[model samples]
Target: YVVEELDVQNSIYEVPLELARQELDVKTLDLLRLDRRTLDLADYLAWLDGVLHPTRECTIAVVGKYIKHQDAYKSIYEALNHAGIANNAKIRFLKVEAEELEKGDPARILKEADGILVPGGFGGRGVPGKVRAVEYARTRKIPFLGICLGMQCAVIEFARNVLGWQDANSTEFDPDTAHAVIDLMAGQRGVTEKGGTMRLGSYPCRFRPGSRSAELYGVSETGERHRHRYEFNPAFRARLAEAGLAATGTSPDDRLVEVVELEADHPYFIGCQFHPEFKSRPRKAHPLFNGLVAAALQHRQGR
Candidate 1:
């Protein structure tokens, strides 16, 4: 009589999986692989030790309103993990409510952060707090990365604080606002349908030759996934650029700004319209995430 056990937890087949007895024997029933690459266990063990036992850890604060549900930013979390692995460091996320930032000093709340991440989201619920957090990162010289709506909030903050546009805001939040630093895309003009009408999927962003975004990406042109209807207003681009908030990347036809970055005066402050997290993989970390992690590591070491 023959008995079959699936061994679902251990993932073992008909036979048990054990360490090879010194050297693998082809005739042995416990052999797991037929290739030499699989037999090289020494290098694998070294890699495992280094990765599993990182020398240092970092705390990156994710300032957003959806902290109650992590799944809202699952891709961003995974991308940060991928970047952590690439840097051989452990990353811990500190969830900060955006509403709190508006009520008080963001520096006090984000004081423990090795880096600050402002993720994408819709609506005007916690925008003031997000702007405050961006202000904290910018003024404190902390490593900062803003995505999608985060980018818009950064623009609003810059317009208000730097460009003197006291009432700067996004059209999505206040359609009648005087200074709409972020406005609805041209194609989305007067579109009543809200379901899946955003500029979704992959789109190419042309980077400036010597810009920070290009340097981090190591390419002049790259495509990233985007899911948004609002974008940086072209009318305010010149003012923002003249004030040092340069548009480092733009759409293929140069009709839309895809990336904005502070100059060399700042340690690392960048914002992107595309969601870089969606492209990150376990083995392949996205450049934007990798850059953020690296900058965070540097910031931690310097302190």
Candidate 2:
């Protein structure tokens, strides 16, 4: 009925609003004598307009193993949209299958991307491809944001290539690798149950005073949700930091690394162990995503 009666271009919210205005009577408000000014939706409509119509565009290559499934990374996709809306740009996702990146040239596949993002995931099936994507983004100075396992891959790539740890890997992928840059949290080793075993829910992260993570967030501390067990092994923190992969955010006690970034020369290379997408909303984009989209716009213009 809406498609046939109302302008097809109207927003879904606008359609309902128009229907109420056209079909419903104002007698109810009149009888109650409620001020009509209270029902003003001008600000909301303007914001909706911005979301529906962006002025610019940027392509983001989302490297992941489950790209074939639409709902697999639904939150990540939606968060990117929110970020795009915040930046006044349409986010065009180039869903590059992680397994495909394992065999294909990442440079060629990702050359057109204004930004590169690798969302959270489990297993080791296409880790090599994800690492390759991280490497490309890091080397090319392209805007990059890695979440959860994506952050782990970023550390592994940096350790292997920059730190000269050729076999650097996450214990989740290589339980016996000599260089376990990423390891299961000490508290999680004894867990046998698959359900409710991983580190989950919101946690506070204290950002380093001058780090990019803190700068982007505009605060020294913030809470972000998590859904992973493996973490940046503290044993390799100094080594990694010496090579430029700095742990810029950590747990309140400084026992766990929550955020990592290469802030020296890179435009925007950040990885967060927590799932920032979980808290993102259309009206307020997460800072990490906001920064990535803004950096992507800059990268696009530079190209």
Candidate 3:
């Protein structure tokens, strides 16, 4: 088998998000080039091709630490597959060792993917890799779908790389980022272990007007089930927004954050503080999952 020479530089481009938007050179965007021979710019389409089945598809790398128990993430995987089938495509799932990503170059595996998803996990054992992958997506303008811890990593990635917050971190992992973007809830009690002390179950979210999620679910305010403990620190919301990151969806009382999308521009970059997969069915896929698959399809067609 002939191996393709890797684009090590593609690991992370330092282009400002807006500049990346202006220049069509980024790998994640449409790889279309002008057809000088004909003097008419042609829309170069990259078919899902060999990668797709009856349901055309793109490979999406799901980098996380909990691959051992597919059941722990079963709902999530199935929901993605459901979306693929509904859209006449298959959602490719790849589980990777987070430490491998952190210790060395993960650009190869990350680049092979049409999208990257960072799911929830506990402890700091594999968080840096998750954050690294988020950085890959953010800078490259890749179709990124972050959930729970994934959302936290997306925030941490933006905090450190774009906003210049040096010690950005989740309190779940470290209590000491210069700015603590994540922290434990103050009102909780009855702890058996640090493991189970999280806020779980269903919660309400108040959406910002004209947000991507607000339009997808057909309402500004909505409810979704969750199985997590740590929440975004309420104090950092404004700081994050000022830096162009949005806590677009929040709880009814506005105490808990629910979803975050790009402030503006880019196709489908969304991170949710909740797992919508738990409620997705084979027939009716969750809107969030549907949205992610849609982005992958767009990326595959060189858009």
Rank all candidate structures by their TM-score, best first, as comma-separated numbers: 2, 1, 3
lDDT of 2 at 210: 88
Worst 10 residues of 3 by lDDT: 38-47
Candidate 3 local lDDT, 140-259, one digit each (tens): 777888999899888888888877887888776776667788877776545768657866778888898888888877788877888787788788888788878888899888778889
Clashing pairs in 1: none
Clashes of 1: 0
Candidate number with greatest TM-score: 2
Cand. 3 TM to true fold: 0.78
Each candidate structure's TM-score, on Cα atoms with residue i matched to residue i, is: 0.86, 0.89, 0.78
Kindly provide the TM-score of model 2 when superposed on the true structure, using C-alpha atoms: 0.89
- List model 2 lDDT by residue over 102-202, tens digit each: 99998889989999999988899889999999999999999999999999999999999998889999998889999999997777888888554688889
Superposed by TM-score, candidate 1 places the C-alpha of residue 35 at a distance from the truth, in angstroms, of 10
Off by over 4 Å in 1: 1-47
Which ranges in model 3 have alpha carbons more than 4 Å from their true place?
1-55, 68-70, 189-196
Residue pairs with backbone atoms closer than 3 Å in model 3 (clashes): 55-88, 55-89, 198-229, 199-229
lDDT of 2 at 94: 93
